[model samples]
Target: MRDVAKVFDRTGSTLGVMDDLQVALHTYDGCSRGCAGCVVDKHFKNNWRFRNIMTGPDMRIVGERVKEYFHWIQENLNTKSDGYFGTNGYKVDHYSYTFRFGNHSELPQDMLEEIAESCPSDFRVFSTAPSDEIHKFVDLRRTHPGNYFLEIIYDPVADRAQDIRDMVLDMRSNGILGYPEVLITQRLLQAYSPERFVEEALGPLGDIGTQLQLGRYTPSKTRGFRTTQVVSVDEEVRWMTAVAKGIVDRKYDIHPIPIGEYAVTFLDEYKEAGYEGPDGYIDVARLPEPEPFNIANVVKKTRDIFLSSIYVDHNLDLHVWSESMGQHVLDRNFGFEPLGNVRNRPIHEIVTEPNGVLERMLREVVRNLATHPKCSGCRYKSFCASHAIPLFRKWQEDDGEHCYGYLPVIREFQKDRPFLTNMIDGFKELGF
Candidate 1:
C-alpha cells in the first residue's frame, strides 16, 4: 500500500516507489531541535533532536492509504519511531537510519547499534548529523557497498557551527563511501556568500549531500507561519562558484545523486544541436556562447539576494507558472520540432530509472525550457536544469508539482515587458 504509482509529465507511464517504513522515518519532518528556519523542522515542529524515543506525533504517515492501510498501518505503527506498518508485508522501499550516539538521551548507542545490526533489508540508509555516526555509516558502506547507503543531514545554520564541522570531519575520516551526504540550506548559503557556502559544502564532507533542494516557501500546512520566501539566479551562481572553488581547493570527492550541476554542464554544451526555439527566440549565432555556469550563477546570486534581502521592498511585478513547471519539462524531453532530428524521446530519458520521478521531471523541464519564459532559453536554464519538481512546488503551490516563482523574479529585472505583460497591464490600467 505504501507503493504508489505517480505519473510524471516527461515519462508518460512510470511507477514511483519507496520503502514506506524507511522513507517515512528517515525523512524527518518533525524536529524540535528548535533550529531556526529549518524547512522540514519548521514545517513539522517537534522535538526530534531529543526524540520522544517512546512516542511519535499524531501526523499521518506519508504512504498511508487513508481508505486502505489506515487501520493496518496504525495497528503496527510504533509511535516511538513515528513508525507505521512495522507488521506490514515486505516493504519494498526498505530504509535503515543511524543517529549519533551519546548526543540525545532518548535513544542510546545500544539502540543505534541494535538497529544497524538488525537492518531489515540488504540495503539500508543511515541519516545522521552526529560526527561519529557519519563515520560509522561510511565504514558500514565500505563493508557493505551498495547494499547499505548513508545520508548525512547536518544544516550549518540550523545547528551549531561546531556540530556541522564535526560532522564534516567524520565524512573526511571515512572517504570510502564518497562524500558524506549533508543538507545545505538556502538560509546558510544565503547568509554567508556562496563562497562561504561552498567552502563548507566542499569541506571535509566530500559530496555535499544527496540533494541540494533550493526554492521559496509556501504557506506551511502547519499554521502560524506566514509569508513566502524566494531565491533568485545571482544568489545561486555565487553559491555554485563557492562550491566549485571548494572542489578545486579541497579535492573533495563529490558525486551528484541526479548528477545535478554536472548534468547541467553536460547538457548545456550539447544544447546547440538540440534547441528548437520559438519565433523570436534568439539564435545561438546572435549571442555569445552561453556560459556553462551562467544559469547556475544566476540561480545562486538571485537566490542569495532574495533570501538575504530581508529588508528590500521591491514588490514590483509578480507572475506565476502553471502546473508544477510542466511547460519547461515538456519542451526539453518529449516533443520534437517535427522538422528536425530531435527524437520524440529525450536522450537522457533513455537511461532513466523508470522509478525516478525526479529524473522524469528533469527531462520534461529541459524539454520545455525553450518556451517557459522563466527559462529564457539559456538565461537561467542552469537552475531549471539543476532543480527538480520540488523546486516547482515552491511556485505551483497546491497545484501538484508546478512553479511560477521565476515568472515574478523575471518581472522584477525585466526592463522591457513582453507583449503578454503589456496586454495584462493595459487591461488593469483601464479598470476593464
Candidate 2:
C-alpha cells in the first residue's frame, strides 16, 4: 500500500518549496538493510532477495492495502477539480512526510503498528536499527510523540564505531529524536580521520539533538541480466568534493544533502542476457560538459526535473516521482504505466487524464526544451528547459549516463547556503 496517503504537485523550482500536496506512505515488502550502499542492493541484484520479514498474512495485506488507499484519498483527491493544482491558484495542502516513509528499512513492529494505526499522514520513523531492533520500537515514543524519529546511519565505510556508539546511546535513552545520516564515501573520503571521527564518533553525541545529514553514495544498477557500476560525472564530483571537505575539517554543523543527477541504464534485457556492466564511457563523456550552473542548483535540480513525487507501490501501483533515471528504481516511472489503479480508478481521474501519459510527458518537456541545441547553451537552461531537458533526452535514450553528480557539490553548496542562492535566483525570474 504505497503512496497510500498520496498527494501531488512538485514542479519547477519546487514551486516555492513545495506549496502543498505530499503524503507518501509505505508498509514494506523487502529490505532487510544489507546496506553496502543499498539502493535496493543496487537495483535488486540477481533478481531480488534481501528482505526483512513481516508475516501475519503480511499484516493482513498491509491492513487491506492501507485501508483501501486511505479510502481513495478521502474519496478522490480531496476536492478542487480540473487540476493545474485547481485552476492554478494553488493551495492544495496534504503535508505528512516528516521523515521515513519506507526504504532505508527497519520498521516492522507490526509494520510500525500498521503505520501508526492505518495511516492518515503525520509521519516520521526512519531507522537503521541496533539498540536491540530499536528497543522494540520504544512503544513508538509512548505511541507517537512529535511523530517519532531516529534517522541514524553514519557509515564511515560500513558502520561500526561501536555501532554508531550504541545507536546514539539507544537514541538518548529512548527519549528519541536523534538525526544523523552522513554517508560520503571513497572510503569515507580517503580514510576519514576527522579527529577520531569527531573524537570517538561524533564526540559521544554531545548535542543529543543531532542533525548532521551530509549524504552521498549513489551508483546502482541491476535488472534482468545484472552488473552495472559505472561512475563519471567526473568521478562523482571528486568524491563529492572530498566528502564536502570531511564535513568541513570536522567543524561538524552539517546539513548538505543535494546529491542529484544519476542516469545510466543500458538495458536490452541486460544485453540479451549476456550481462557484463561497468564502464559507462565517462557517463557519455560528461553529458555536454555543463555543471557550475549557479543560481544555486535550481531547487536541487528542480527536484529531479518537474516530477514532484507520489510513490504508492506494493501492488496498489500509482507512482509519479520521475528522477533517478538509472541505478534503477524502475527509473522513477512518472508514466508509461500505472496512472490509475488505486485499486481501481478515481485518484482524481488518475490525475486529470486529458490524454494523459503524465500530461503528454509534461507537455513534451516544453516542446523538447523549446527546440533543443544542447538546450541553448546550458546555464541551467531555463531551469533545464522547464525540468531536466526531458530527463536528458531519456538519459540519452536509455543507453544511459546523465549523472552530473550535483556539479562538484554546487560550489561547496553555495558556500553554506547563501540564502539558497537567492531562492534559486528567484526562480530564474519567474520562468522556472
Candidate 3:
C-alpha cells in the first residue's frame, strides 16, 4: 500500500497524495431545531423524526471503525520513500486529519466524547443553538488539547440574537473560543438586503470571539419551500459588494470567511505589482483597484481543489464528497454512488485500489468537466472542477441554465473592484 501511494504521489495523481482528509460525520438521525427549509431534512425519504437514530453504542462502534482507518492511513500514507522527489517538489512526512461532527444533526455528549477519544486529533464540533453541552466541549478540549473549532449556526429568523451572543460569551469565558477557531454561519437568502443582513444578523454579534461565514443557499429538489430563497447572481453580487463596503466603511472587527480570503488575494496582487511607496510601505489608498481578472486563475495557482477528502454518514456509508451523500439521498440516479460503507470495507481499499470503482468514477467526472464546452471556456472552470460531479449533475438537471452558482459573486468582485480594494486596504490598516 505504501509503494502504491508513493507511485501515485510521484505521478501527481489526486488519489494517493493527501495532506488533509475531512471526514464529515452525521452523529444523530434527527434534528430538534425544526427550522424551516432545512437542507438536512430534505436528505430523507420521509420525515427525519421517523428515521432510526444511532445509539451511543452504535456511535462507539462507528468511532472504532474511523480510528482503525485513521491508524491505517497514518502508517501507510503518512510517509514517503527516501530519495523520492514527488509532485509539488516535497516528500510527505506528516499531514493533518480531521473528524467533523454534527454537521447535519445535533451531537450528544457521549457520541462526541467517543469520537473525540477515538480520533485523538484535530476536530470540529457544531451546534445550532445554545446548549449546556458547551461546557462539556470545553472539558473535552482540556483533556485532548488539539487544534479544535466550535461552529455555531445562527439563523436570524429562527434564533434570538441575545441567546447566540450569550452562548459565544460563555464559550469565550471558558477559553474555548477565539478568532478563526470560533465560526458563526448565517445563510444568505434571496430578497434579504445585504445591508440589512449585516445590520440585523451580524451587527449584534459584535466581535464576540467569532468569525463569520455567509452561506449561499443551494436549491434542493426535495425542499421546494426554499426554492424562492435561492439568491440570484445579481443579488449575490450585491451581497458581496455590500459586505466589502461594510468592512471598509464600518470597520467591522469580524473577518468574513471567503471575503477575507478574497481580500488577501487582491493584496498579494497589489504587492506583486511592485507598488511600494516610501520606506518600502505601499500606500493602499493611492493604488487603483485591481483590474478585473479571472478569479479561477487565482484559485488554480494556489491549490488543487480536488484534495483527498471523504464523507461518512451515520449509516457508515462512505462517499467521494460530502455533497455526493446529499445527492444520493435526494435522488440516486443523479448521485455518485458511495464507494462503499466503512463497516464493510477498509478506507484504503475504497480509495486507493487501481481500476477500482472509486477511481473509475473520479476519472469519468474529471473527464466530463475537462471536456464540457461550457466549462472549457468558463473562467470558474478550475474552481468548478473541485466539485465537478454534483455541479455537473445540477447543470444537466437545469438544462444548462446554471453556469455556476458563484458567478454572481465573482462578477461582483470584478464589478466592484474599488470596493474590494478598499476592503483589502481597510483590513490591512486594521492589522487583520
Q: What are the RMSD figures for all models against the true structure?
A: 18.7, 19.5, 9.2
Q: Least accurate stretch of 10 residues (summed lDDT) in model 3?
A: 1-10
Q: Write the per-residue lDDT of candidate 1 for residues 1-432, one digit (tens) a residue.
A: 123231112122101112232221222333334332333433223545434231222112111212122233333332212112133322222222222211221344444444444333344444443445554455455544534333444455654444554555455455523223333335555566655655654454444332222323333333234333333334443444345444434544433222232232222333422332354332446444655544333333222211111110011111111122211111111221111111232212222236443334434555555445445544446444433333443333323222333322222112112322222222221110
Stretches of model 3 off by over 4 angstroms after superposition: 1-19, 42-52, 55-65, 71-108, 142-147, 178-191, 206-209, 219-228, 262-307, 322-334, 355-357, 372-374, 378-380, 387-432
For model 3, name the residue pairs that clash. none
In model 2, the worst 10-residue window by lDDT is 261-270
Q: Of models 1 and 2, which has the larger lDDT?
A: 2
What TM-scores do the predictions have?
A: 0.41, 0.31, 0.65
Model 1: CA > 4 A from native: 1-32, 41-119, 131-147, 158-186, 199-219, 223-229, 242-246, 249-261, 264-371, 375-432
True-vs-predicted CA distance for residue 241, candidate 1, Å: 3.9
Give the true-structure RMSD of model 1: 18.7
Tell me the tens digit of each residue's lDDT in model 2 across 251-368: 4443333331111111110111122224311233333344443333333234222333444554555555433322122233321365555555544456556876555555555555
lDDT of 3 by residue, 1-432 (tens): 122111011232221123444555554334565443455534442454433344455456556665666566555544423211234223333323333322322454555566566545554544334454676777677777755555565566666666767776777677655222222122334424667766766676655524555544455444653455544544454556665455445555555545443333333423322444563334445666444334443223222222245566666776654222121222222244666677767766666677765656555555555567755544344334444433445423323345433433432333333444433333332111
The TM-score measured for candidate 1 stands at: 0.41
Cα-based lDDT for every prediction: 0.33, 0.42, 0.46
Ranking by lDDT: 3, 2, 1
